[model samples]
Target: MKLQAVLFDLDGVIMDTAEFHYIAWKRLAEELGIAIDREFNENLKGISRMESLDTILRHGGKADDYSAEEKRDMAERKNSHYVSLLDRLKPADVYPGIRELLLALREAGIPAVVASASKNAPQILRALELSELFRFVVPPDSVPRGKPAPDLFLRGAEEVGAAPEFCIGIEDAQSGITAIKAAGMTAVGIGSEAMLKAVGADVVLPDTRRLSLEFLRGLLSA
Candidate 1:
């Protein structure tokens, strides 16, 4: 039961960028004559940029029939909007107790990493000044597929030099949990306990409210 490392999901677990996703995507969707809400934005969580565009376009009633030029045009537009919204990105966006958790894990000699599907993850980590917090940034593009298939998380665990059973994964979406489990790791869900349980998380914490050094150490040690 010796935990060797931790793998974290970016948007929901470490930072609250899901709201930014919703806002930017909603704006883009409207311009394209599609309607979506915050709830609908949830469907795009943990997916790659290309997959995200495809999903949104499909939901709006088009298939992979999009021309290469059209795909690039739409993706660039969305990235432009999404990047601009980050002008307001602040340290406050990081969840409470996350820094504490990282420091504790570091003190315990446990490696930590970001297993994210975002192309913007490196920029976000640098902007937050938390780039050095993780042993490596396992980008989505490196893997053949992203979450729910476990490719990214499995790679992340390798980066941390930990076996799946000795690592704990933190995520906010059902797809994330599925990915972690598929990788043979423990999945800890954040955001909503009930919703995460419904998604089959091994453990669900309401938020970072109760997360602490001792609590995590206790779990990992157990």
Candidate 2:
């Protein structure tokens, strides 16, 4: 196999926590008396939970005002809110075709691992009951730097006993694509085809729905 493993981004790739994150951030922003709409939440998607907090704080002009204690308190509260909403993420919410894709990877001896910037990656995986499929998980705390830096995916590939060139990184956000490419690996975007392509993903699929192994092969060949 040209690809020895697949490294997936957690938030939007495997777990369907987009709306959950949106609602949590919206509620927190509102409680802080900040203005946050759908667009703001969309921008935060696929980022680490702490990174998401920093984004919201910066957007609200509260980053400068927040003391170290205040930032910690806010991050903790956001985690509380996020954990409360994770009950919505059941096995039923695992992305379309994900089961088959994981099975195929395992059968072919291509280990799959999650490389996310989210501190909540473990919770999400536990909720989906798909934890067993992964060979390793490199969560936010696993790296000193997050996406757009390439540290996360590089570490994930190493942890899975694979080279970056022999691994495919699946992501949706533009920063994620940039990180994957910077890590010396090809990328398969997991969201809208056109937008993903515009970001220069090697393979762009609307979703994981009709995705196949041949599609993955074609991406490697191209």
Candidate 3:
């Protein structure tokens, strides 16, 4: 199979915005008198904002405490905090091998697209100054569902005019790996190998630093 396009998950795959997200969420949880730890934050990865909020509320046993409008307000508040943190980001914040891999893909005439669940994806790309490297950043609202569902990845391949079988999807979350597999694309996972493998990732790398154009091509060839 030929590699037609590469679909990327933004937060952990391209950079480390996951920590910013954790900080924001932790702040929100504290405001609600709920406690959350890093291990719990892992469950929030690769999910929508509303979904993450819901998960947090459930965890705190306060799911029924907020009205729908109150929940929206809380989510907005968290996003505001997250966006504020993003101002600290710069082009150099991109992970070790990501920039080089993206450039290599460009040189090889391969297209890349962001398939993140984050509504702030475009802003994040702009912060990293890597907006031009990707053909499109799939809008979160455009898809009916987020990670752990195939909608986003499927739409990403469609946007790039690539069939799912001919695409490679890279993600740092198990939910995202599941989405890639569900979309019928090869999954290149970043982060814990066992966790990603359990979710059916085709190949698991420890971090973005290990990603390379040659490694990607090898996946397709194999």
Candidate 4:
């Protein structure tokens, strides 16, 4: 089948907001009396905000210590910190070649969708001034489950009226790759070839800077 739509992940794949996420996560960890590093942050990628907090809390052996309300409060605090950091974002914050790729997909008559786990996806899109570029932007609240479960990407395809086999998903995290595969779409990984391959991505690119319709089509045909 011909490719009908492309689904993108928001943070590490579309923008360099990983730093902001890490900063907020680290701040929350410190306040919660836990330790976190960049390596630990890698585990948080492509997951929900509450899930990220839970992961760090579990790492600190404190996951079961907090009540549900307390956990929600912590997540909210982290989000407030993250929202404050978005002030520094601009169109320039978009990854190199991302806008061009979106434009190319547009010129080629392909619909693009963003399937990020971030609940603040809409705000992030507006901050980057790329809100109008997508056919559908899947909000985190729209689905009960996030990446690694296939719900988000599947919903993206559904919202765009594309069949799973006719959709392509682009992501920079292991969980995202797993989700794409589970959704039965073409998985395009934006990171190291070895890591992406290990996670079962159909095609892996070093970065979006190398993305082209020809390369993608060839991969699909292969």
Candidate 5:
């Protein structure tokens, strides 16, 4: 039950960049004459940029309208917009207690790693002033597949020099929980308990602000 590392998803788990992502995507969708709302944006969580574009097109019933190259261009445009919004980020943007948890993990010899589907993960971490906290970051391009596929989480565990079974994956999306389980790691979902339980998360908490070394150790031993 020894937990050697904690793999975190950057967006909702580390900082609140979900809205920025949504805004970027929504703006891109508008350019394509497709409307996007927050509910639809939720589906983009834990998915790659291109995959998100695909989802957006599908939701708008226009998946076949754009060629692959056009979709690539659209994804790039969305990313540019997203990056522009990143200038608004500050150290205070980090969720309460997240810094404490990272410090605690480091003090206890446990590495913390970022395993995010965002290609801009490193930049976002820097913007949030959290780039130095992680042992390593596994961004979208680091893995061939995104969430629910296990590759990203597995890479995170490897980067931290831990076996999947000895790692704890903290994520706020169901796809991320699926990926964690598929990687044979312990899943700690940071959202609704019932929803996370339905996806087989080992533990569920309202947020990372609620996590503590004692609580994590208990979960690991349980």
Candidate 6:
């Protein structure tokens, strides 16, 4: 099979913005009298901002306590906090080997794009100074649904003019792996091997440092 495009998850795969997300969500949850820890934050991964807030509410048994407007306000508050944290990001903050891998893909004539669940993907990419490396970043709003629905990854392939079967999607969340599989693409997970395997990832590397063009080509050849 020929490699056509590479779809990347921005938060964990390209950079470590997960901590900023966690901080923002935790602050929001605290203000709402809903206790959220790092363990609870895992459930928010690969989901939309509203979905993450809803998960927090449900966790605290307050899912039905807020009106739609109230929830929107809370989500906005979280996003504001998250965006503020993003200002601290630098080009060197990008995950090790990710820039090299992206450059290798570019040199090899392969297209790469972000299929992140984060609506602030463009801002994050620009902060890392890696905006020009990708073909394009798929806006979260462009998709009808988020991870586990396959809309985002499918859209990434569409944007790059690649067939789903010819694309490779790298992610760090279980929901993302499921979405890639649903899109009929090869799922390369960049986190816990067991956790990703449990979610049907085609391959799971320990982290982005293990990701490379040669490693990806092996998957394509398989």
Q: For each candidate in the order shown, give its overall lDDT on alpha carbons.
A: 0.83, 0.83, 0.93, 0.89, 0.89, 0.92
**1 or 3, greater by TM-score:** 3
Error of 6 at 182 (Å): 0.5
* Residue clash pairs of candidate 2: none
A best-first ranking of the candidates according to their lDDT comes to 3, 6, 4, 5, 2, 1
Candidate 1 — which pairs collide? none
Per-residue lDDT of 184 in model 1: 88
Candidate 3 stretches greater than 4 Å from native: none
What is the clash count of model 4? 0
Error of 2 at 50 (Å): 2.8
lDDT of 5 by residue, 1-222 (tens): 888888999888988889999999999999999998998888998888988999999999999998899999999999999999999999999988888888898899889998888888888888888887789888678677888899998988887789988888889999999999999988899988998889999989897778877777777798
How many residue-pair clashes does candidate 1 contain?
0
Which parts of model 4 have CA positions greater than 4 angstroms off?
Answer: none
What is candidate 4's local distance difference test score?
A: 0.89
Residue-level lDDT tens digits of model 2 in 4-50: 77889987788577787788888888888788998778878766767
Question: Taking the tens digit of each residue's C-alpha lDDT, what string does model 3 give over 77-172?
Answer: 999999999999999999999999999999988899999989998898898999999988899999888889999999988988999998999999
For all predictions, the C-alpha RMSD in Å is 1.6, 1.5, 0.8, 1.1, 1.0, 0.8
lDDT of 1 by residue, 114-199 (tens): 99888888888877777877788887778898888999988988876889887788999888998988898878888787878886
TM-score for candidate 3 = 0.98
81: Cα error in model 6, Å: 0.8
TM-scores, one per candidate = 0.93, 0.94, 0.98, 0.97, 0.97, 0.98
- Please list the residue runs of candidate 5 whose C-alpha ends up more than 4 Å from where it truly belongs after superposition: none
| Residues 1-222, model 4: lDDT tens digits | 688899999987889799999999999999989999999999898889888988999999997999999999999999999999989999998898888888888889888999998888888889888887887898888887888999999998998788999888999999999999999999999988898899999878888888876667777678
What residue pairs are clashing in model 6?
none
Model 6 regions more than 4 Å off:
none
Name the regions of candidate 2 deviating beyond 4 angstroms: none
- Considering only N, C-alpha and C atoms within 3 Å, which residue pairs clash in candidate 5? none
